[model samples]
Target: MRFVTDPELTPELIDELVDCWTDVSNAGGSVGFVPPVTADDIRATAEAAFARCGDDDHLVAGFDAEGRVACWLILGDAGSWLRAHWRWVLRVMVHPKHQGRGYGSRLMGAADAAARALGVEALHLTVRGGTGTERFYAGLGYVEAGRIPKAIRLAPGDDRDEIYMVKSL
Candidate 1:
């Protein structure tokens, strides 16, 4: 249950993240995009996260017992000036093959602890509108902060809500 963070992104690291992220999205897990996602989509996200945005952006990952990256979660700040009281949680994905285990929870707990160590008071995250993912976050002590309808649209006729959640540190 170890979480690894690196501010610098290497080719090798990008490939690994793209592979795992693509796998999860294709398997109907929402990490940012809809199902049947491609490597390009994930690579684009990695590039943005890896870029020098002058704010706190980290690539936090966790390896499985077999040394495979089974889960990852992005722990970042508000990306604005002098606002670090809360961190944003993004891309909290557990490989489809590794679901049902506590890999996601472990990663989240570690991230929470890490943020707490930095004197952060709470964490904010959002889940897809219709995925029932809010329940999962709620179980981890997250509460509903807000919800935006039709905030996500995968297809012309497919639209779901975006649910914002928060957990006190």
Candidate 2:
């Protein structure tokens, strides 16, 4: 697997991003929104995000043996007022078919390097609390910073807590 900073996210990249999002949601990744999320919604969101990446943001993509995008990790510089010394890991998703192949870690390692290059002091991300995914982030050197109870409403009748984690560069 190889990591590349997506300078311009074309329609093809958007399609691949949607596929990865759908697969993760269906597999209960709890990244956001929820299962049954439409392709149009995913495309619209990704397009907007890609447009924002034009500034001081980095979007890293992972390609598989076939040279197709298999995963993506987004890192955005912290706002000036908030402190430019940090970069927030916005989204990290690996296609279900590509999960367990170390693509996620590869993407994360690339993001960490990108943040360091941008003079960032640390990287931050939020995950769903009480889930096994916390262990994954922990293994990546992200320590729990805090948690917000019932912070995310995934489904009509379901609510999940948010776990904020951070790692120093």
Candidate 3:
């Protein structure tokens, strides 16, 4: 159980992360985008995201004993001045095979620690409304701020709301 921060996003790593993303989305995790997320799109997106990390943001990954990436967590740098008081938890995902193994919570704890180190006083994230994940986040001390009706479009014919949550460091 090792936690790494802002690892250089190699093509292989991007592929793994994208696979996890696609799996979770199809299974209805609701991080962003819809199912059928392609490996190429993931590669391109991850490249840009990693470029941002090179600037200031942080991307944390959890690797298992065998060195396989089990979970990923992203935290953006506090904006110029106004947003310096807080950091956001973006795109948190644990491989479906790794779910229920406490990987998500471990990754979140690492993200929280990173935020505190960066002088961020609070952390925020959004979960799909009506999903058990919302309760999972709540159990981790995140309070429900509100919900955006039909905030997520799952597919051409499917849509779901999102619940905003925040936790103070």
Pick the lDDT winner. Answer: 2
Per-prediction backbone clash count = 1, 0, 0
Per-residue lDDT tens digits of candidate 2, residues 52-151? 7857778888888897878887887677856789988987888888888787888889888888877889999999865778899899999999999988
lDDT of 3 by residue, 1-169 (tens): 8998878788787777777777776666666766566656565666676678745688888988988888887887657777878877888989888888898889999998888877789998888765678888888899999988987776665677888899999
Per-candidate TM-score against the hidden true structure: 0.90, 0.91, 0.88
lDDT, each prediction: 0.80, 0.81, 0.80
Steric clash pairs (candidate 1): 129-161
Residue pairs clashing, model 3? none
RMSD of 1: 2.0
Q: Pick out the ten consecutive residues of candidate 1 with the lowest summed lDDT.
A: 50-59
Candidate 2: Cα lDDT at 104: 81
Cα displacement (Å) at residue 86, model 3: 0.9
